[model samples]
Target: MINDEDERFNSELDEWRKLPVFKQALVILHLVEHIIEGIHLDDPHPSTHYKLRLYERYTRQMMENALLIPSEIATADSTDLYDHKMENATIIRKAAKEIIADSKGLQASGYKEAEYLELLYDAVEEFRPLFAEWVQSFSTKNFIIDRWGLFNPPGVSYDDPVDTMSFDSKSFLRDLEDDWDDGDDDDLI
Candidate 1:
């Protein structure tokens, strides 16, 4: 019997066309990079499969933030300078989808770092009259960690998530288990 998660993921992947083009692009591109980085053989390993499984767990998280462009811009209470990041994120996701669909798309175009750098060029080129000022605003600000692992100015304090590699086995052994609880309590007569 198929469970909820499998049913949901299968349905989503099957109905990928319904999602915004950019969003599909983002996720697909992310997966593509994952494959290239992990399964390309030159830098490949068995852990690639494991990492993909790990990535699947957080797949929905990216989709949740795709609309921040319109959301931030439309409902922004602050200046008009930096609202583009939201839209840029959306485009980045879209482009990623495109890249995933066809690696030859941008990689063939000589993008050094195909994931973020590919889109970064367009963003930089289209700057000014388009969004140069906003980009400048971001530059001037301090490097606060963004949800995407990039930096930002002091805005919200986000909890940096620790990866699996950070787990301390020794500490886990020392503190996480209390197996001595078979309390052979002496019920003295």
Candidate 2:
């Protein structure tokens, strides 16, 4: 049977792939892959090892974060879509920053040259404006009040009173029962 999470992921993946920010994220991934191809840790120096490890970790994170963006986008429910989107945007931006920083670390250690790493940096630089535009498009209307100090929409705070709404368990169960009752008996057989 098809599950809701899978269905949501599939739908969001298609829409996300069409987004310019998503496309640029793919480009950054590609550049990361290409750059890593030339990175080597054969040197015996411990600092070189550390720098190479940091570069590897950040690049891997970039790939993982890019893949996670769609799932994060799909996780929106009745009250937290904006938070998820903002969180994912922060993830993307942090990945870009880490990639650039670690690449410089590698350059300082002579594992990779700044000139060659410039391409990867440039791709991430290009992704920034696209990411900003995508973030600006998120609406505050769909959000729940964030109790944590983080991820709240602008001018909102953790100290603000929680929303007074409460879930009606009886009504929710009634709806679920109605859905089950409406199912064709033949489907169970």
Candidate 3:
């Protein structure tokens, strides 16, 4: 059976696919594919092969990061979701940087063509502004008071008092057990 989460995931996938930023990411992925396709995976030298492998791994990670963006946006609106999306963006940025670095390494090692590296770099450069715009579109409102201090909006602090009481799972479970042990449970059925 298709459950709620599956439905939500499909919906979010559709939404993100239509986004210009996501489309730009896909173009980058296509460039990565071409770059990978041009690599000679059967290089005789082990170190050269390893460097090529690293380049492929970083490019694959970039693709995965792009795929994760939709799910990050699909998370329930809260400070937690904002934090998660920010974290994803950070990862994407790091991966893109790594890809460029690794491309240079591959070129220096004579394992990759300058043309492919330049193409990949150009694609990532094009993707950057779209990525920035997408990040700017995230809503900072609809967030709960972030108790950890890290994800809270500016002007909010972890030490700030809130009206809602914290939930006590142990106390709730104890009361539930007590109710189950009592004879009144018969009426609940």
Candidate 4:
């Protein structure tokens, strides 16, 4: 038996889930920004650890989604699909950089905010290059169909099927192995 507020919140979450991946990433970025702002404002109840955890979770999600964009672009069936994926990729990258810059600014102030900003800076530094690599991997591709034909070309089937690229969760987890060493396990919550 859920209350009205809980039901409404769940309904909203369902709608939110339906949004495009980049939009979802933007929402997470905004959430991270808001949480940092709250910390700056000296909100007493949530504590630094709680806020840092939330920031980390949102940043991680954004990074993971951004990192997968190149594979998505590479596998797109049409130019329109590739263009859409590229647009989303650009948005996610810019948003990520913005968040990183914001965290850096906070860190530079030499105040209490620097402590939490350091956590964010560390997380962003660890994940930011992966997103950049994904973007770079796609930039050299010839997406214009009019200028050039498909990599497979029409009526040219190959003996070996090309494998579709996907997000590798194992590799992602391995990259973050150090962060998980603390065994805090609050991420399960």
Q: How close is candidate 2 to the true structure, as a TM-score?
A: 0.69
| Candidate 4 TM-score over all chains jointly | 0.34
Q: TM-score of each candidate?
A: 0.23, 0.69, 0.62, 0.34
Better of 1 and 3 by lDDT: 3
Please give the CA lDDT of all the candidate structures. 0.38, 0.65, 0.62, 0.47
Candidate 1: list runs displaced more than 4 Å.
1-46, 57-62, 77-117, 124-189
lDDT of 3: 0.62
Q: Is candidate 1 or candidate 3 better by TM-score?
A: 3
Per residue, candidate 1 scores C-alpha lDDT tens digits across 93-127 of: 45334333343333433324555544433432332
On residues 1-189, what C-alpha lDDT tens digit does candidate 4 reach at each position?
236657986775455234343344444444455444455434566566565665555445444544443334333312333334455556555655666665544444323555555555555554456555544444323322222233322333333233322234466688789657756565456
| Residue clash pairs of candidate 2 | none
Error of 1 at 147 (Å): 25
Best by lDDT: 2
Residue-by-residue lDDT tens digits, candidate 3, 1-189: 236657986786576567776677677667666766776666587786667677666656645654544344333222234545565666666666666676676566565478877887887788788878877776654344557666555566767766432434466799989967877545545
lDDT of 1: 0.38
Model 1 RMSD in Å is 17.5
Name the best candidate (by TM-score): 2
Candidates by lDDT, descending order: 2, 3, 4, 1
lDDT of 3 at 172: 73
